[model samples]
Target: MMEKADICHIVMYPSPGRGHLMSLVELAQSLLRRHPSLAITVLISSPPHLLPSIIPYLSSVSSATPSIAFRHLPPSPSPSLSSAPTAFSDDPAMYFEYARLNNPNLYHDLSELLSDSQPSQKPKALVVDFFYSVAAEVAAALRLPTYYFLPAGANPLAAFLYLPTLHKLTTSSFKDLDGNVDIPGVPPIPAKHMPSRMLDRSSRIYGHFLETSTRLAESAGLISNTFEALEPRALKAISEGLCVPDGRTPPVYCIGPLVAADDHISKHECLIWLDSQPSQSVLFMSFGSMGVFSSKQLREIAHALEKSGVRFLWVVRYPPPHDEMWRNLAIKPEDDPGIDEILPSGFTERTKDRGLVLKSWAPQVAVLSHDSVGGFLSHCGWNSVMEAVFAGVPMIVWPLYAEQKLNRAYLAWDLKLVLAVAESEGGFVTTDELAERVSELMLSEKGREVRGRAAEMRNEARQALSEGGSSRVAMAKLVDSFKKGMM
Candidate 1:
């Protein structure tokens, strides 16, 4: 007799950011590993990238697993959303305004597409992105088994997926200007601490994002790109929020920081350097893919790293400046988009013995797990935050871009799990400040205390991956649902 297949999985997500896209792809890979008999298909909004290397990694899922496949759906044609200049490329204030105007139809078109697709075997299950819960509405209409896949950090999703309700309780639930509010699950997430963009109610698009994500949180099961122990309170809240009519809550699993074996183009060099440094001595820094700093701020960061007098590893992947190009543009920093001259002069040489720098994709998990690495200086991206916590490293949070500033408060102040580095006068901090913060973390007693707690968190995080772990249990139940159609 021919071999039999167990389940058919269809995954849907829109890839506006690397973190979201990467998490969706990893979940597919993980499901493939655990249940090799499953046939998985991932549906994305587009089949392109700004950086060519991103194209490969995005497409890596297909290469890694022959049993898994991909399909692309176009965003319904629109005048502005159709290849427009984002604010960073032109004017930030205006671009976001445009995105806000386009939400209703954008949601409608995606929802319609999910509704129209017909599967031959009744799709063993539907796994959808947290941001596109409208797709879940379609899946529900079709009566297909469904699961929610959050493509960002679990803690953030746990908070955001509940934002509309949270907004109802606090006056600060809004669209403009940063405000702080207490997120009941975690510690107090201050209203002033909210990301500026998320506070605007006038923006239909922002509202849609929160509304859609919140719906996904209430699905039959919620899947996170994180482990349970990292943010137990948030995970529990998410579990309770998705309660079924029968007094049962949907399953929520945290299996993440989906460390890619290779980024599809380059090998990870950070791991090699980590081997050379002493235990907890190297401060690992990466501002996430979208991190941007003015020329002045860039210089200050270089200065700070140099002044710290601590061994470090940093990844710089910015595109070349308008006026300056990398000396070996066509190659050299091979995997990088092109950022050599964008870096400060003599900075690399000044810290040569103590620092190791890479221009492109480097092995992140390997570096975090290395003995030489101690603290992480991060941009507060959920994936990066999860990785640091899972690895048991304390963080020096320096949020530079995107909803990250909101996360900074959660990590540094609310959780008391990571140290928060203050932003400077010009909305950007200087290297002197960075160096000073480095000292506070490495040389001071307060730094030692935070590190001690972070180390303790590390053990707790690992326990979630152990046998009978919460995350493991969730994953098993999810897989079982696909076969039994309990979803």
Candidate 2:
């Protein structure tokens, strides 16, 4: 029994991709846990192929948490893939960007749904992913306050917020700026380590990034997927308006390290293998949903893993076109090619005793939570980083695309939670370098120190989420702000 005056309805729109969707869902769950009578409607802007995989999870969450609900936006009116960001058309992210550019459909459908709703069903505030920034105008038209939900760490948000200032100060592109050019709240990072999209002003994706950042700054508030203890300096800089000129940055609520629960524990064989291994003896490697490698890179990785002598569970997927096929249809083992087809000849046979080469996706959260797992070799996606921190696992950073390079810099150089596998000429990491780094992280005293730090961070993450903790207080403030129309 909570009072009717305490209830508030919040509409959440998550951009496409599993990481973004998962963060938003976890935030919704956390809100319901902390505040009674809070209702959430998650409006999804995912592709047709991706929806089937997510619907079951949404159904389970809805059944368990009565206050949370879901809705899918209708197809785009102009569903042409050619209208997508032209700079990186081959990248899988183009699909989401295409959906985002055509988000007038989401606005139209949401308006219709809200118009026909009862007074109780009306949303008090709208919360949206950074990609779906167009929803800010929709929220304004409906007289609802909007908050931008940044699924990445505060470092990326700070970078985005200050990018305009950096652009104005420099005569050339980001690629031409000094390697040590500093952004407020973040370490002085080289242009190579900054987000690649923001480097070239002529690129379509660059323009989109610029526009989204401006829109996010103009919103009522910001919700970041990071806890206060994890990023105190970055959070403080944003709140104090160090990045934005004129001290006009929005109020920030850091209620995160929001990770998925291990719901599919019984669904994978790797868990059984992990149960038999000694404590803290295994490594887990995964690139987030869109991470793919060429056949040459896969062979190099296989050789490196064999050379390291460390126990590992690696999730491998074929290069895209085939890699993306799972999104469109159910992935059957018989239908998809085996590891033998992709990896070097006899690679699996040689490593079968100490390694598990799982094709495509694995139950990541379940695998990370296993006692036998110690270190993660990852693409440095923010969700994966948070999950690793929560599980007390150190990392070897292997950034591939998007904002991952920045994440790698933050984790390995700034936060000291990870070791980076250095890339050779042409952005390809040498086999020897990969093997050496893996061995160091899985065996050396330096690795032990990093592991200890990770455990300490895990404790801090728990503390931030506990009762009377920083995240709990921030969440309370967020709810109050939305409810009172004070944002």
Candidate 3:
């Protein structure tokens, strides 16, 4: 064990969402595992609405890892929807604003942290989430080196770095564009298939994203939660400056497959159920944390699952209100309607023999790593995609929001490791389409091919993290750059 005076400290600031927070925490853990002489302090500025769900994970990390500390910044008020912004105050923009509002608190707390530390223990670098690029200004004000940590793959990083150029090339919203948007490294994405947040150019969220993407080049370096073998072309495009044509791109680091640590305390019921199934027999369906569907969509999915006849475990959250007025209400877990209320009548009884439907949450990392789990019906969030990839589980990509569609495009088209589920207008997946996709993913020859690719990538991911591997080498370079105070 290293003495306090011998340790190198680093500060990390993650954006508000659980996915963002979890990814950064995983990265911190990975760093400490490789460099025990390093101490990491994660500054969390959790939004009020998301605080409850984030607390348990925070507690768990704190208890499990003493070297990785967390300091909770004072909660900032949510951006008022009535305050002159367009009727498009989405969650992404709100999270950005929330983080921006905490800049003063961050500066004060960070200053004290640095001032109180021994000279050798002072933070060598400050890492901010991709969405929290604005915090880079605070880091700069403190004369600290800043790095942008993107808890995503290189494909999305390429698209984000290219946003400024894309903005200049088109005047209309992405949804209104006449043709495909050409992004470096990835396949030509249909304008409509762009991230939902980037669809409406006039929205404040799009403005935030554009500004964040533009400022990304100002960082000392970018550390992505991806490896070379997983996204070779995309990483190459970024390294070659194809993503940022107008500016000098910062050094890119490919070190990833970082996922949440599993707390092997007790066996979850879901895992026990998996134990009863055959190897590679169960299809695990889980949308991300904020993934919720309407009642109509729930029924359609129920119908699909029943028709597919595949053994499955599905985590279902309460359906959002149909009325826009009630959509923002904070629904408590205790208030969540019963499974019977949300699903089709008698759906649970019909599928009980071969399927298990969990309410709202499950041990996602453990489930994906289980042998009984074969295919994933996922929202294609970067973290979820990484988890599935690391587990070698094939997927049926059903993206919901954020950059998930972009992730879907990469997974389905570029990587060919997952099958894409087509959605009808209004983003509804019909029973037929969902059933067919599930069958194709679970039983078809194409599914077998995709599975093979996923397994190969999984091996590649393992190798990249092994001793003297590509990701390990990159990690060493990143640490060296920080130690040398290189910009």
lDDT of each: 0.63, 0.80, 0.86
In model 3, what is the error at residue 46, expressed in angstroms? 2.4
lDDT of each residue in 61-85, candidate 1, tens digit only: 6776886666555543454554553
Point out where model 2 deviates above 4 Å: 1-5, 81-104, 109-118, 265-267, 321-335
Question: Relative to the unseen true structure, what is the C-alpha lDDT of residue 223 in candidate 2, on a scale of 0 to 100?
Answer: 92
User: What is the Å distance of residue 236 in model 2 from its true position?
Assistant: 2.1
The clash count of every prediction, one per candidate, is: 22, 0, 0
Clashing pairs in model 3, backbone N/Cα/C closer than 3 A:
none
What is the alpha-carbon lDDT of model 3 when measured against the actual structure? 0.86
Pick by lDDT: 1 or 3, better one = 3
Give me the displacement of residue 210 in model 3, in angstroms.
1.2
Best by lDDT: 3
lDDT value, residue 19 of candidate 1:
57
